[model samples]
Target: MDWMRDWVQAVRECEGGALGTVLCLALLFVWYCYRVGCEHASYTPESRSSPPELSSAKLRPTLGGVRTGGGASEEELNGFAYCQSPECFRCSRPGNGFNQRLYHNLQDYAKRYTWAGMGRVHKGVREQDRYRLCNRPSIQKAEVFFLPDLPSAPFFSRDAQKHDVELLERSFPALLAEFESVYRTPPPLAPGWKANSTPRGHWWTFYLVNQGTTLALNARRCPRTWRVLGQLRTFISNNVFGNACFSVISPGATITEHYGPTNVRLRCHLARLFTLDAASRGERRLRPTAGPERLH
Candidate 1:
């Protein structure tokens, strides 16, 4: 070993420049080999089989009150609140005086509106063997309803028709334009709430306020966009006795199954924003399912 060392030293001294360069190159090769080996080990099938366990410690409560993370506590988050939650209901009550007018308007309009169209019918048997169904829930599910198409249903009157058109043209155009601007793209203004669902193409919604005003627009309605405006006018003229809103759900998105509280009021969905997936549609998914539907 001593002799070998002596010989190596002599070679280094005699070929110092070449030896140094070779040494550097050899070190670089070893480093490259080590990096390749590490990469292979990291990407091995077994290593990739299970993703790194997400750290529950890093999870946080979102504003919507949903807890996320592998080990997040099942307990509901404090700050996060569902729109349908009792607390939210209290918060959402129209402010005194300000909301009174709004409420009165909606109530009056609703009284006159006789919902029509092919309203949905819910019929099913629960595990208890009891069967039940109604069109009211579908109306509520969509967060809107149509007036019955009858002469007495408030829609057939020429006066009501004129009133409805005036409301749509004056009050709703700006509101609809605002809605369109906000939802033209993904990731709506509200966090964790998409305006649309991935499976359902889009949602069409209408809003009726007190003071004889009506608003209607489709986030994704095509061609005669004005037609939707006209429909709102017609519906309101016939049914706008009480303050109310209307909605339409196009085919494709199954609003999933859900329930609501109270039977005195109904909800409806006005289909708009049509797309392949309802989940990816837009904002407003976070909005409560009208009045009666309860959120689980």
Candidate 2:
């Protein structure tokens, strides 16, 4: 309600003849309202009975667009926390031509800006990369580098451990059971890794968390594994790298040596049964005799 009040007040303060800004703002408002309405409409009383938690989970954006809920503390969650800085709302920078053109109502004004108008007004200014991994001097031979502050070790086991990697390893039986239950029936193993051009065999991924947001239907199917993942805070929850999935690789699959989009995130594998051979040239060859394997 407070946000709504501020948004309306900000609109009122805008001077006349700012037709471009007003039209853009109005279209954005309509889009927001439409999305809200459609979301609510999808959740009927009868539909709420099945997959209740997943269907009814309320997702509100936190600082830097990170979403948090389900009893996880801010510290436990990774990536950038929710932001409420004045810069998040303000657009009227002195001597900025784009700000002056876009935010004529906010230019040189002392009043606080609204969140709804924030995106529109701040369009011209390029947001600084919150985490740059490759630029660090210490980082070398890394494929993707964003948020290089995270642990970049080649491997960790026995002594060196950040979060509870063992917990996931121990819960393999329960997690695998849940995973099999989802893809076992009609839509068994959805084809994945369609974008990768180099893989010789096949790679299929059933994701629980895609870009830090939990998939409702998938989470509903794998409640046990999801709960297990909740115990560990190391999962990359950033926009791109944030994902946890069950990977099924065909036998003799040769996933060519390739760097992920970014290296700030760590890749952990919890194989039910698989033999991986690192080639001399850095290629990864997977030889799996089992049914399916889980990877995070």
Candidate 3:
């Protein structure tokens, strides 16, 4: 009974000590937590400045006004000036004002007779070529006209007549032969005629007179020429212009540089004769003179 009592007392004393230790430890822990929390609350997050609000109306500027200079001017900011601005006009206008006006007027005039339908046979040519032939989407039947310098009067009596390729084929061969005979020999290699040195081979060309009345037959007289003309007619009816011309460029022939009167015309070369290695091949444009005599 004495041992039992002694063991109970010892156990009670140990339990009491453990309880006190636990209470002290818990108090220490609470103190540490409270200190950390108080420190965190004391260090409030640094206040941040808000970004400036942009006005929607200020995004695009008025036409004549200068832009805010954050870096470049708005015109400079966009990397290019607006097209309608007077500054843009001043910068972008062509150097030749008179020529520009003349060109614009000529374009307006050309719109009246320009073909609006797909080109008759050369439609399959390159897009660039087609554009050169006619600016419109398709060539209409009544817009064909002859150059005024032709030996004969204009052929078409009225604009109502449809252009027939068959007739052209029957007539173009003689003209081809004539052109061939005259241009067959190798072209001159002189400085002024540099385009004459390229190798050339003969080829035929037929034009559909969309607006003209000049019969293909009117251009020829001989029977053999008529046969050649017939071939041209057949090709035209079939809508084949890919192989029509025989192109030849002299070895070193440099065609002087000159822009066509309008962007609608494409130049085609039929190679009838050529030299193998002469320096006269292809077209070249001469530089314009700096002074009043601009011989280009």
Candidate 4:
């Protein structure tokens, strides 16, 4: 207290000694006050965040086909038309509380369970000879399908374990039953999709979900399959891209070698009714083809 009083007395004496000194002190005081006010305003809930109801209003779409609030429409903020509903898995609105948490959690999960989409080079190989080890046979007639700048692997045994494909494998009987009950007749075939290596046969596809979207009618028809699909966290469930389907390649049909559109996702194939002869391994052929493949 004595020190405080002495300091105050000294400051008082200094205030009377020079006008320039007083002006400097006054300017410092004003700056300090301004900073304090800003800090206080930043900490207040009213300044930091709006009421939930009011903030939610901004997320809602208006009559003009643009999002409201947040100082600008979504189109203006992103500089293009971007309309992902809050419910979508890929709706990455980090400003919103739920989406922010979800986005971070997904990122963490992906980091732990997935490859970061990098095409790995063989260790200890010289940079100049990198292509020598990875290249295909020169005699192959068809052009090799290549998706640029993505992790390439012949198999994904690790991804199968990460996605818990064994869980789906255990429930295969239920999935098969659902498939049987729903699709009594052969599902339609893809024409422009991929022709049979020979012109005589057809390849049919029965899809419960396609392009990260659950077909409502198909989902309703096969509840068990739908329920099982939802349990896998790493399954490509985004509305923008991904697929879950049953492909039936008929006897005497040969599907020509093809590549998937992207290399980021592991294309998993579950043999619902394949024999385990000496040539075949166990039922789980957790093959990683060149695309977004998931457990179905």
Candidate 5:
């Protein structure tokens, strides 16, 4: 009992707080070393006896040839070349089934897009605008669009006239007069628009409603225009086609070919306006603006 009491006194004199702090620091140091070792193990490379799963199994003779002088591995000796196909195995080889069909039973035709001799000409060193137009016979000759099915019984007979044309005819004269009134005091054309104009003058837009889908502005001043639009509101939703305007392109004014943000709806042009709707190979719709024309 006396020896035990002496041991306890010795420990207290040695300072137990210092001992505890040292032990805590030692533990933290060990943990940090363990974390560093784990990180080192992750980056270290390991040699595999077999190739990666993504690599092809079989190989043939390639023009790149065997490793000439160095002590190379089996993979290095087997030179690789990529044919113009995704399923190609042998690189630089004469025939690795570059144009092979996936299913033997399937029809022999261009199933999807395949690279068929593309030119790689960068304009500048950095300008890498690649254009790969599909010139496949199967793709080009495919019957894509079909005519809309119609009923034998006609909705309107030969004598039956369109109501829309009649409505336009009724409102045309009044609208024309109002347009002349608006034209008497036309707003100054936007600066950028004048430069882009083909006639070297300016193309103007008289907005009945603003481009934004809110309350109709400037439509109130033109009552006749508003009434005609109200009659057609049943056909077109106010929420959708709110922006209505009469674009006045002068005799030589030519707006460049362009596309709107969305192609959900077709633009409604009332009069003799030259319009060309062409879809690119990428399915992007290219819109041609009204060319220079004499307006009556």
Candidate 6:
């Protein structure tokens, strides 16, 4: 009976100590939460007399209102966008104004800026930019004695990329399927022009032609793309002076602002596939099962 009483007393003491500790912890947590809530409720915007600088120690801004690198996620940006302020990013205006960036990479900022620039121009500022392609100096014809110029043929006409587009349209499904099959397959990642990581949603490239040269190995790997490009050899034999590859920029991935070395080439994007919330944004989602009026 004495041993039983002693054991009971020890258990009671331990339980009482544990209960007191738990209550103390609970009170501390409640106080912390209360302090946090009070701080949030009392928060006010800091004076914005000066332009916000995002760390002079890092993230140097580049030409064309681009920054090389930063630290932010799309989710954070989206949450900010939902705030009552009418700012493009974190302010109270439609325009971000003065080299504002949202994404970690400058490319995303450029794309978003371009998207904003697509809107109707207000006052003197246009969201869109117009820049001329700089002709390649080395490829300049001595007899011509001037900058290189493309043929004056209508671009979409039968003589131009019409056949190429048609063939690609026909083979788009096969390309999509093949891409889905081989894009993430073991050892399927082709080298990027800028070797970004896999987590950055690889800028995967399966070259049909590169710098006026056909890649026999890559073509063998991607037969459908090869067949589609093959159909345009007659039209593109001479004009295929530069790379012709499908550049698949991964979702939420951003490539920095860059201009090709030569203006003699134009990279073409045949088709795009993305998933987005169509209902909220008042845009229709084009699904494979949806009415394909133009598929015929």
Estimated TM-score per prediction?
0.23, 0.42, 0.21, 0.41, 0.33, 0.38
Model 4 misses residue 245 by how many Å? 0.8
CA deviation > 4 Å runs, candidate 6: 1-160, 186-202, 233-240, 276-296
RMSD for each model, in Å, please? 26.7, 23.3, 29.7, 20.9, 28.3, 25.0
C-alpha lDDT score of every prediction, in listed order? 0.36, 0.49, 0.33, 0.49, 0.40, 0.44
Candidate 1 — what's its lDDT? 0.36
Model 5 — which ten-residue stretch has the worst lDDT? 124-133
Give the distance in Å from residue 204's predicted Cα in candidate 4 to where it truly belongs. Answer: 0.9
Stretches of candidate 2 off by over 4 Å are 1-152, 185-198, 274-296
Model 5 pairs whose backbones collide? 81-91, 199-252
Best by TM-score: 2
RMSD after Cα superposition, model 4: 20.9
What would the per-residue lDDT of candidate 2 be over residues 47-157, giving only the tens digit for each residue? 423432211122122354332343343322321221223322111111234324435554534255445644532432221121111122333222222232345555545
The digit string of per-residue lDDT tens for model 6 on 169-281 reads 67888877766554554234333222323323445566667646777766676787677666764434342244566555555654432223223333345656556456647
> Candidate 5 at 34: error in angstroms?
53
- Higher-TM-score candidate among 2 and 6? 2
Q: Over the stretch 117-210, how does candidate 4's per-residue lDDT look in tens digits?
A: 4323112111211221233332211111122334444666645556457767777779767755644543443221222122225566666776
Query: For model 5, how does the per-residue alpha-carbon lDDT over 1-29 read when each residue is reduced to its tens digit?
Result: 99999999998977887888899999999
